[model samples]
Target chain A: MNKIEVCFSPELIHLHELQGKIVVVVDIFRATTTMVAALANGIEEISTFADLEECRRMKSQGFLIGGERNGQTVSGFDLGNSPVAFIKNEYSGQKLAMTTTNGTLAISKSANADEILIGAFPNLSATIAYIQKHRKDVLIHCAGWKGRFNLEDSLYAGALVKSLESSHEADEDGALAMKSLFEKEGHQLKGYLGQASHAKRLQNHGIEADIDFCLTLDLYDIVGKVENEKVKAVIKP
Target chain B: MNKIEVCFSPELIHLHELQGKIVVVVDIFRATTTMVAALANGIEEISTFADLEECRRMKSQGFLIGGERNGQTVSGFDLGNSPVAFIKNEYSGQKLAMTTTNGTLAISKSANADEILIGAFPNLSATIAYIQKHRKDVLIHCAGWKGRFNLEDSLYAGALVKSLESSHEADEDGALAMKSLFEKEGHQLKGYLGQASHAKRLQNHGIEADIDFCLTLDLYDIVGKVENEKVKAVIKP
Candidate 1:
């Protein structure tokens, strides 16, 4: 059986051996959710940058720039880190250059992984399907809030672990804890995740809709794969 | 309300601000449990060293030396990391110099905190009462398996958060997650923690008794406080 593990925060990423693992990078509050939404709605590809200046630089090359810092949109960026913003297909066929406080940094830090997949509740099923197909050791890398553990991403990891339990064995206590967390609270995703610190942070910014939307499961039947630093949609077979 | 937070592992200690906080350093499988047991059973004071050599050298000074590496006793140490070994008061009235793979390292790293307390399930209520009496911001620093996240320590953290819930607010997602975990599995702690990676590690070495002893609640009514680099038992008022 393939092994599944969880790295609760990007700060703890160094402790994980990523060389031959398929890392499912999750930022459930918005970043990975937004990527899935953007790709599912016809955005050609999503390129993530850890630096706002680097993401903004792509605007001159016709890429739609999206950046957020501390849960707010960068002053001059075309979009904030919101999945709802990408749902209308308004930027269909465009390439997105995005940066966020946690998600993009996690993606960049996971460069050594054998394969990187963007994971969120919206794309959870597809992400599991992809992992099941590949049968590689999996690491769910949660882009926690500013290098601290967060609830939403870990819940997403738990959901994935539960789904993949038949074929994959949870490799450590982190995975077991998350799997148990999801089992207990998975049914009330919105209500449970709404209590998360990151949820409260976003709620304080008056984005309850984004939090609700981000917790919606299986909305997109596509997997987001990081290829050459760009996230592209992988439709289910 | 006072704040309660959990640092899931020593490796992630750098991300947490330890100053002015009371850190409850826990190694549920053995180290802290051993300390609590040793102090409760009449050991004079316990000094922790991260280096086995330093611990070994203390023997020449008439201190009882206990050391472990990777779940086994280090060669030539006076005792392995076992609470049972200390329970008989075999080394009563003697100072203990100890080193272990994770617990000692966690205590050493948490020296920046205002107050350092050794925590274990055996003293769960006492630890809670001590925290309530102090009413300071608390950080439950789990001495996870070699700087990685582990179940037993986090569960102990969760138990503290839950018991202190009325007076303390969870400071972040880590604390909140642990609180929920404890609430969900607190009653069945032995069965729940028996599945932990570290528990399995110890069980493989034929120390199932230690695992049971470590998970037992309220085995002693003492809080081990670190002062001048020594853990001296603080009896409950």
Candidate 2:
């Protein structure tokens, strides 16, 4: 049996053993969704940085710099953390330097995993189909807002588990509870996601479109995996 | 407003400042349930211990001892981690020494709180009613298994949120998410809890009654709170 464990927040990522597991990092409010949209719309390389200085330094070397804090665009950067900003075909073949409040930090922390995939509602099916091909111990690592548990990330986790075509028994109470939430609220996800604190934060900044774009299901047929610290598309076997 | 934040595990305990907050400790599988039961059935005091040696020292000094590890009773202790064991008239004036895997550890971690109330399904209504009277910032500290998020605790966290009669709202997505899970699963809790991994652990040890007793809503009229490091009943005004 391919057992699944859902790590609800990155703050306690150390409690999970990621070394040999297939880790799928989900940051549904923005980062992972934007990464998928960028790749599908044709950005060649998206290098994730946990530190703004390092991400800015890469920008000086010719990468399109994109970073944000608390939903607003980072000063002196090309983009704010929004999937809407990434949904353009003009950015194809560009190497991008990316950083965000939570998602990139989650990616940096899961550096020990054997295979790391970026998961969000937009690219969920592709991500799930790719991982299902390989029978490995799976852990859904949620990049919760600033080291605390958040709804959108957990909702994404539950949706992923429910999306699986496996026998579908959750490994523990956390997994079981998440699976239940997704099943009940998965129908009106927009109504639910829109109520999230992070969603409200983005909405407060006048960016409800970002939340809407992030919640769009299966927008891209791309499965994103981490390689050399940059997230890029990989073909399904 | 009584702002509520539900801290899902001890790993995220540091993210919550307990200094002036009213922290409600939840470990529904046994510890908090047993504490409420012991106090409700009339034991004078139940001193919790995170360290086995500390709990054992009290046992050696003529206090009645009860301990559990991985859902089984600890060796040489008078009782296992069952709330039913405490529902007796004979233990009315005796003090108790308790050390468990998760619940006691949660109490030890929240030693800095202004007030620490023992929360479980047994004391659910009383705990909620007592906290609403004192408009302090509330944190529902869940004793997750081995520093990871667990379903039963999150379910209890949700139940507490839904039971609150206050006009206050949840502070973050975590609180909202927990509240959603509790309201949805609060009805078929026995079926839901029976599906949990921790419940299975107890069942494997032939302790189904513990699960039933833990799931009982508001079994006790008194709220168990920590003062002077000892758990005792407090009346609601």
Candidate 3:
């Protein structure tokens, strides 16, 4: 059986062997969810930057700039980190550049993986189907809130592990712990994850709708593949 | 109310602020469990060394040296990382120097905390009592297997958080996740943790008895406090 492991945060990524694994990078509160939403809505591609200034620089190169810091849109950016903003397909056919506190950093740090996939609740089924077809060792990387563990991303990781249970073995304790968490509380995703620190942080900023949207399951049948520092929606096999 | 946070691994310790907190370092599958057992049963003091050679070198100074690597005792050490060896109090009044794959390194990394306490199931009540008396922000540092997240240690952390919930707030997602884990599976610890990777590793080495012993709750009323690199049993206030 193939193995399924979880790296709780980007900081803990080094402890996991990524050389031959399919790394599913997830930032459930918004970043990865937004990427999936944007891609599914017909955005040309999504380029991620770890720095807000770098992401803004992409605006001059004809990319729509989206940046957030501590749950708010950066001044002068065209969009914030919200999946709802991308769902209308208003920015359809646009090339987007985005930066966030945690998500982009997670994708950047997962450069060593054999394959990198952007993961979120919206693309959950697509992700599971893709992994099942590939049959490689899988590592779910949660972009925790600023390198600290968060509930939503880890819960999503658990959701993925639970979904892939038939083909993949929960390889490590982190994966097993998350699988249990999802099994127990996943049905009440919104109410349960609302108690999360990041969720509360976003709620304080009046973004409760974004949290609910991010928790929506299988909203898009899209698989995002990270290549050349950009995440592009790929056709599922 | 004071905050109770769980740091899932020693590698993630840097993300937490430890300056004014009471840090509980745990390695449930034997290291911290052994320390609690040794200290509770009248071993005078236990000094933890991260290096096996350094721990072995303490033998010349009248210290009983114990060391383990990958679930087995070092060939020349006086004891292995098993609590059962210390339960008889054979090393009463003798100081011990020990090393292990993950435990000692966790203790060493936690030096920045205001106070460090060795924690395990056997001393669970004692640790809870100590934290109640101190009423400080608590950080449960789980010494995961070789800097990776382990179920046993994280479960112990959850148990600590659950016990302290009346007096302390679950401060982070990690803490809340662990607290939920303990509440859900804490009652059947042995059976639940028996499926843990570390527990399976020890069982493979023919140490099933030690796994059972380590999972025993409140077997000791001793609180091992880290002071100047030596863990001395302290009279609970």
Candidate 4:
């Protein structure tokens, strides 16, 4: 059987040997939520860059630039780490170049993976179906709060593990532990995330609405796949 | 109010900024379990070393040395990782020098902490009471499987956070998430840990007995303090 693993944080990326694995980049507090929202909202694709300068260069070439640092939008980007911002934007058939505290960095680091996909609550069922179709070893790469493990990302990883457990082996304790957490707290998503660090950080900035929106399950029935360094909607034919 | 935090793995040690924090080192499969069991069975003290050479030298000086690598006792050490092994060997009024794959390394890494105590399920309640009495910010540093996150340590850390919730604010979601995991799995430990990586590794080596004993709740009414570079019994004095 194929296996499921989790790199709990980007800082722990070195701890996982992800070669040839199918990877899902998750930044549930916003980045991944935005990616899924953009895809569902009909954005053409998203290019992830770890370097702000690279994202800036892409911006000059007509990419709608989205960047964030320490929970706020970059000084001049068209979008910050907000999914609702993506949903509201009039961006059809356009490229999104993204950089953020954790999400983009996690996506960028997964270059070695055989396949990479954007994941969040909104597109969760789609992501699972996609992985099951591929039937490859999977790694859920969580973009944590500034390289530290965050609750939202791990919780979503847990949800994925729970959905896939019948067909896939939990490669490590992380997979099992994460599934247990999601099972225990899956029902009270909004209430549970009220205690999350990143959620609280956003709440302090008065983006509690974003939390409620991002935690909305299966809002979009699509999976965003990374190909040629860009995340594009893998809408099944 | 003091804060409760968890370093889900030692790899995130830098993210912890452990200075001035009361740290409880946890390597639940064996090391911290052995430390508490040693104290419970009346071993005077233990000195943890990252270097096998240091432990070897201490052995020459008549310390009952314990060492492990890949779940087996190191050559020439007095004991391996099993809590039962320690309980069987009488070492009253003597010091133990220890080195292991994860636990001792975690202890050595926490040298900058304001105070360090060993934690495991066997000594859980006492460990909690000790921290409450001390009334300091706490970081539960999990000695994961070689700088990677492991299940048992994080679950025990969660148990600590859940028990201490009223008195201390959870500093991060790792703390809250950990507590939730503990609450969910605390009763079904054996069944839950049957899927854990380290537990399966041990079972492959036919040491499920160790896992069963290690998960036993508050089996010992003791707390082991790391003072003067050694872990000694803190018997309410």
> What are the iRMS values of all candidates?
1.3, 1.3, 1.1, 1.1
Error of 3 at B176 (Å): 0.3
- Provide the lDDT at A178 for model 1: 94
Off by over 4 Å in 1: B70-72
Question: What would the TM-score be for candidate 3 when compared with the true structure?
Answer: 0.97
lDDT of 4 at A186: 93
lDDT of 4 by residue, A1-237 (tens): 899999888888877878889999999988889888988888888887777877878878999998877677888888886889867648877889987658878988888999989889988998889888888999999998888888899999999999998778886888888898999999998999888877778888988878998999988888988899788899931
Instruction: Report residue A93 deviation for candidate 1 (angstroms).
Output: 0.8
TM-score of each: 0.97, 0.95, 0.97, 0.95
lDDT of each: 0.89, 0.84, 0.89, 0.85
What DockQ results for candidate 4?
0.79
lDDT of 2 by residue, B1-237 (tens): 677889999878888889888999998888899989988988888888888778888976778898877666788888877899977665777889998768877888898899999998887888888888887888899998888888788888888777772644786776788888877888989998888888888899889888999998877789999999899889631
Clashing pairs in 4: B158-B178
> Residues B109-201, candidate 4, lDDT per residue (tens digit)?
888999999998888888889888888899999999988888988888888899999788886888988888989998888888777888888
Global fold similarity of model 2 (TM-score)? 0.95
Worst 10 residues of 1 chain B by lDDT: B228-237
Q: Residue B8, candidate 2: how far off, in angstroms?
A: 0.4
In model 3, what lDDT does residue A214 have?
93
Give me the runs in candidate 3 sitting further than 4 Å from their true place: none
What does candidate 1's lDDT look like per residue over B1-237, in tens digits? 999899888888999999999999999888899999999999989988878898899999999999877667889988888899988767778889988768878988999999999999888898889889997999999988867889999999999999999989985899988888888888899998888887887889999999889998897888899998899998831
Among incorrect, acceptable, medium and high, the docking class of model 3 is: medium
Report DockQ per prediction, comma-separated: 0.70, 0.75, 0.75, 0.79
Ranking by lDDT: 3, 1, 4, 2
- lDDT by residue (tens digit), candidate 3, B1-237: 999999988888998889999999999888898989999888888888888898889999999999877666799899888889988878888999988757877888899999999998988998899999999999999999878899999999899999998999995899989988888888899998888998888889999999999999998888989998899889631
